[model samples]
Target: MPTRRYDNSPGLGSLYARTVKATLRKAEYEPDTDGLTLELPRALVDQDHLTAYREVTGFSAGPALPVTYPHILAFPLHLDLMSDPSFPYKPMGIVHLANTITQLRPIPMHAELSIKVHSGPERPHPKGTVFDILSDVSVDGEVVWNDTTTLLSRSPGTPSAHADLLPDPCLEARAFWDLRANLGRRYAAASGDRNPIHLFKLSAQAFGFPRQIAHGMWAKAAALASIQRARALPDAFTVRVDFRKPLLLPSRVQFAHTITDAATDFAIYNDDTTITHLIGQLVAR
Candidate 1:
């Protein structure tokens, strides 16, 4: 796959900013979900680009697509909504904080689908501000998958962008699972995120990490699975999350999470651990 043409520098235009703010809480903008189903298209499941799709997330030996690929269907629609000219949002400056999803059943490769997107208000941040989005995908009137993502838009501040930096330790510790041969292939086919940084040891080492790192979505999937199993909610509708740090490859580390209320949750490393990578929550639908 080609390098993603991600040039989000300089931010979005003022028109886009104002437009995005205006539609802060658009109610149920439903899309046609007539043939919606958790099925992957033959083109997606049989993609020739990612050789690594056979192993890590397990795409070849099943009747389902890995959990990560739903974003392919959902995100394009998200982009469509954001660029509606009537809708509001500038994708350039927003930081993706976290992604949470629930799977009603395995997504079968080569099925038709549809989606619905919900937008919400800006969440007050400790330093900056954040926004939330909800998207639900269904098949034949039965809901199949859903995701809630948080994007943060920060305002310029603190020392006026020219102050001396304080010595802040890397607050999070993270470890990556080695997936170069097996896991990498599986994740690539499943997620459509075939960035080479996640493919091999040498490829990752060039980027300054020790070895090939796991896909952020893989860890995300694991986190969601953890929450679902613990809460025993096979059909959770929403989730809250914070990405603190990136996890490196070929390793094992501790995982911990705590919930204080309906809308608040924290996930991080154990008190004595240093390799923490992510923090977030699982919310009810």
Candidate 2:
């Protein structure tokens, strides 16, 4: 694959404006053998934003970043690829279906890193189509972190079930979060995932959501932070989550987890635990 390098992160505003044009001039995606790669040769973490991210996502104040935080750095790359002229769907319409992240080593808050994001293979989904976006963070060519994100572009087809991720009825440790209406806006500033649907009620309603929703990555980080509060998470670990549904802002939700000697199983749900929002598992490597 050919890589497009950047000295700095691309501006989200311009990318979003491009997304709008792509949506207006969209065409059906035809699978191709070629793949795109976007790279940042030098990336720096801003402490203030990192601290703010920790506050919004329930991570502790520390030098090492939460396992899910690095995804923010790849947000523009993901958006750029999906909004490119060749992509078929409206960038805003595609849904984040799942994520799998692996930490090879701990990342310090001040380390300069190289981030690369590539378009992975496209496969058939029962509903429509599904694809993977692979990413890696490296310090001088040594990889410290990586992830695979699955996205879904919905169309008319048979609905399928995630049988392996079915919620466990006996999740014991539980907590309820009273999310505020401005939670989306707050997280957007902290995480740089300014998806309009997650930033305002009207913008969300325009996209068919009844209200603004929380970012899936934020939800995952919050869950992991909660899990860490109960038990320590290893420096080398793998955490994977399937986002079941949109979590409307200002909504109260239940979070619970089951811890064992080897791994942790966790989830987020509606206040009464009837509608599941996310299902995840973390294993220390």
Candidate 3:
């Protein structure tokens, strides 16, 4: 493994510009067995950005940051890794299949963090090759938050070493969110994930989407925020979510959940229940 350090975070606009070229210029389709890691040894949260994130993700204003907030901080690292010339595949069109977040402790608003994002060995998947983009946040050398985003590169099918996913939870609607068309733009401004598919209908149409879609992470965060309204999450917990469907923008969605002694099972569904946007389980660790 090789570690690359950044004196300053790379610009998302530039990274996206490179993404178009990466898509046109082909790369090997093999697994990334020789790992790569990117580190930001010193990073601070911006209150303004955090506030904007809170507003968009439905989190409250508080000193303790939202559990998913650090993902935004590590997002640029994800792009940079994929944008790297040595990376095995093009930076665009990778599917975010699943995500798992382990919160060791609630991070404070102003705590300085050492953030790291790394590429793990690619694994077998039914649709194609899958890999983990891992990121973590450390405060004073102790990691407080870590997340694994499982992404898929569509290709030939292969037997996976992984086990079957958990059975889908049964649940009822908890509430509804009227997500506007600009939801993606607002969230991108707050989070720096200016993926065109999430930003404009025309751009998304270029990629075969009928319209702009919501960010999977935003759906996850909004679900957590809805849960927090009824029951505060345990300080230390792990949230595992499978992104089942893309939520098209300007849509009304049903949010549902069932809380238990062991965990909280939740989901986001299309208004009519024909499509499940996401399914997730959060357990106190």
- List model 3 lDDT by residue over 1-285, tens digit each: 788999888888898887777778866554356677999999998898899999999998877999999999999999988887777876688998999999999999999999999988877888887888999899999999999998988887576546236568888887888999999999899999988899999999999999999999999999999899888889999999999989999899999999999889999998977789999999998
Whole-model Cα lDDT of every candidate shown, in order: 0.50, 0.84, 0.89
* Candidate No. with top TM-score: 3
Can you give the lDDT of residue 46 in candidate 2? 84
Please report how far candidate 2 places residue 26 from its true position, in Å: 2.9
Clashes of each: 23, 0, 0
True-vs-predicted CA distance for residue 177, candidate 3, Å: 1.6
- Which candidate achieves the best lDDT against the true structure? 3
Instruction: Put down candidate 1 lDDT per residue, 30-91, tens digits, no spaces.
Output: 33322122222212334442224334433343455445556654554445345443433454
Q: Quote the RMSD, in angstroms, for model 1.
A: 11.3
Regions of model 2 farther than 4 Å from truth: 27-33, 158-169
Q: Per-residue lDDT tens digits of candidate 2, residues 1-285?
A: 666888889888889888888878756555464666889989998888788989999999877878888898878888887777766566667878989999999898889888998877766677777778899999878999999998877777346733224345467538889999999999999877888899899999988999999999989999999988988789999999999989999899999898887878898889888888898988889
Could you estimate the TM-score for every candidate?
0.51, 0.93, 0.95
Q: Kindly report which residue stretches of model 1 are placed more than 4 angstroms away from their true locations once superposed.
A: 1-54, 58-68, 82-89, 104-111, 157-176, 179-190, 193-215, 222-240, 248-272, 280-285
Model 3: how far residue 55 lies from native, Å? 0.4
